[model samples]
Target: MNNSNKKRWFKKWWGILLIILCPYLLFLVILQSNLDKKKKIIFLALFGSFILFIFLITALEPSTEEKIAKEKKKQEQLKKLEQEKAATLEQETKINELENQKRKMNLEKEVKLKAETEKQIDNEIKQSSSEILLIVSNDDKLFRQDFKLMTNYLADNYSYDSILEAKKIAVNNINKSQYSIEKLKNIKCNLACNNLNEVKAVFIKLYILRIDMLKELIKFADASYGIENIATIPEEKIFRRKVIEYTEYQNKIISFFENIKAERETHE
Candidate 1:
């Protein structure tokens, strides 16, 4: 083929393949051609130079297999990194769940402890209230007995000595009730016990007031030589009022105990 025809043929896809893959066959064909010897030598030299240039470029680049292997290694590294991130995320999630569980358990424990403490305080208050009521009840009995005896004795008594004697005995018996007051006051009352303590203390104070009123009535009688109309006297009126107050306080203590008992039964 002419130079132009050869150039055109080399430009085709198969011609380029033949040049790169079958250069030896192309050389043998050139040597057998009817071309001039000098032209053949020049063409062979050029062809040899072109083959040499192709060899140098091929030697400098990596092979297809090595490129594939390197790409696969890079893909594997990316996959491993993703797996590690997923594992780390899973571990962090587990840690968060454990922390939430721990907090819930601690909160439940605190609630249980608080409820137990409150129940214990309520039980203590109940027991103490019962004891104080019994003490007051006993004191009330003693007061009633002395008051009854004094009233009966004074109904017919006409002398200062007997009236004064009755007053002394009544006053002495009333003073004995003061022991319950001291005992109640000495109790350790916390915020929970304030209501019960306050009511009981008021009841005792009213009882003491009644004692003072009785003493005043006796003093009036002693001054009048036990002949005055006791019903119309100011001291007698004051004494009656005190007795009414004492009775009201007694009712209040009773009601307080009843309410406490009702609450206990409901809880049970």
Candidate 2:
């Protein structure tokens, strides 16, 4: 049957049922009236049962409007929660993407820096090798020239005993010499004048002569075989020993010259 007709029919029958049940319940109550306590109890039970039945029927048949309203409210709440969840997920995804980008950028920077460092090290090694080759080539010629000049000058002016005396004199003179550019200019002049000047020039020359000679001597010493007999002669022994001591002094002069050259190059 149609919904309206069914509702009307149920409403009419429900009222009739209540009326019929109520009279029977009232008769029970009246029969128990002589027992006052029983009468009260029976009336209370009937009232409670009637109310309970009415409530059950009303709950069983809710209006379509109310059911639809409840369902709509639940759907709206679910939609709001879903939107919030989606927004949260989107935010998390964005954060993850940003983090990934940052990591990639850092890795790229690190790789770039490492490449630059390796390039710098390679350049430094190339420069150092070139410098070593240049020094080796020039030093041999300079050393030989200086050695010949110093030995000749020493042999002409001083006896072996006199060379020792000159050394003492040089030690004293070193203290008097001022360590300045103007003083160095004066020393150059002074180095050409008297017996001391001759001795000083020879000493300075001898100092430069010893670098290659000392390196050779050290190599010979480190070799498995002993130094050659020709290299071990008394004269050769004295010359080599003298050059070894002189090389120490020459190294300081060489370092000074190098510093001056470097400064000039830098300014240029």
Candidate 3:
């Protein structure tokens, strides 16, 4: 009869009730001789109907324990789903970080590649120019060509139709090759080669070479400026002074080159 308990259609409760009730009713029949048979049958039918009703109610209701178990299973599934979502999010974050790092590295490499390419171009330019000047200085034909051009510009009142012979006469007392414009230009070019100390040496060589080249131009200007003869023109004095100054600079460069070369040879 308890709602919390379960029961089958026919089992121990029904059989026990029949066993005890039947005997009790028989006892009642035997005790009261005046009792009617129809009254006993009615009493028995009422008791059977009440027990059947209780059995049906007990059998049809759902169990509390099974419902609790189902709720627990549903909660566990939700918790597992939440954990899987968290793991997926974490994995995605890690992948994004890796991709960012790869992108950064690629960008750095691109910038570095561009910088190196520019540096290589500048180096090639200097190297090639150095080679050209060295060839111009060493080739006698090229040197003579520049010399003739410079001399032709020298419109001195007196004809230097044989300027080569006259030039040989003027420089006979000194080393002509060392003080020549071509040799000084070559020294300036040699600064680009792998033969000297870096910045300071290149600056010094270039400065001195400029003087060497400039003095020769000054000589042509002095000769061309006035129609007067060499004896009367004060320009002759200025030209000779510049020539001396240029000669001194040439000596300085030659000295540096010779000293450095010797030092390198000694160390080797």
> Which of the numbered candidates is closest to the native, going by highest lDDT?
1
lDDT of each: 0.71, 0.51, 0.52
Off by over 4 Å in 1: 1-66, 157-162, 189-191, 198-202, 205-208, 218-233, 257-268
Across 68-105, the per-residue lDDT of candidate 1 in tens digits comes to: 99999999999999999999999999999999999999
**Tens-digit per-residue lDDT, 109-204, candidate 3:** 999997886666445434544443343235334444544554454444344443334344334312343344344344443323443224234434
Per-prediction RMSD in angstroms? 7.0, 15.4, 13.2
Best-performing candidate as measured by TM-score: 1
Candidate 2 global TM-score: 0.43
Candidates sorted on lDDT, descending: 1, 3, 2
When sorted by TM-score, best at the front, the candidate numbers are: 1, 2, 3
Instruction: Give TM-scores for every candidate, taking all chains together and pairing residue i with residue i.
Output: 0.63, 0.43, 0.36
lDDT for model 2 = 0.51
How large an RMSD does model 1 have?
A: 7.0
Clashing pairs in 3: none
Q: What is the lDDT of residue 46 in candidate 2?
A: 78
Which 10 consecutive positions of candidate 2 have the poorest summed lDDT? Answer: 176-185
Compared to the true structure, candidate 3 yields what TM-score?
Answer: 0.36
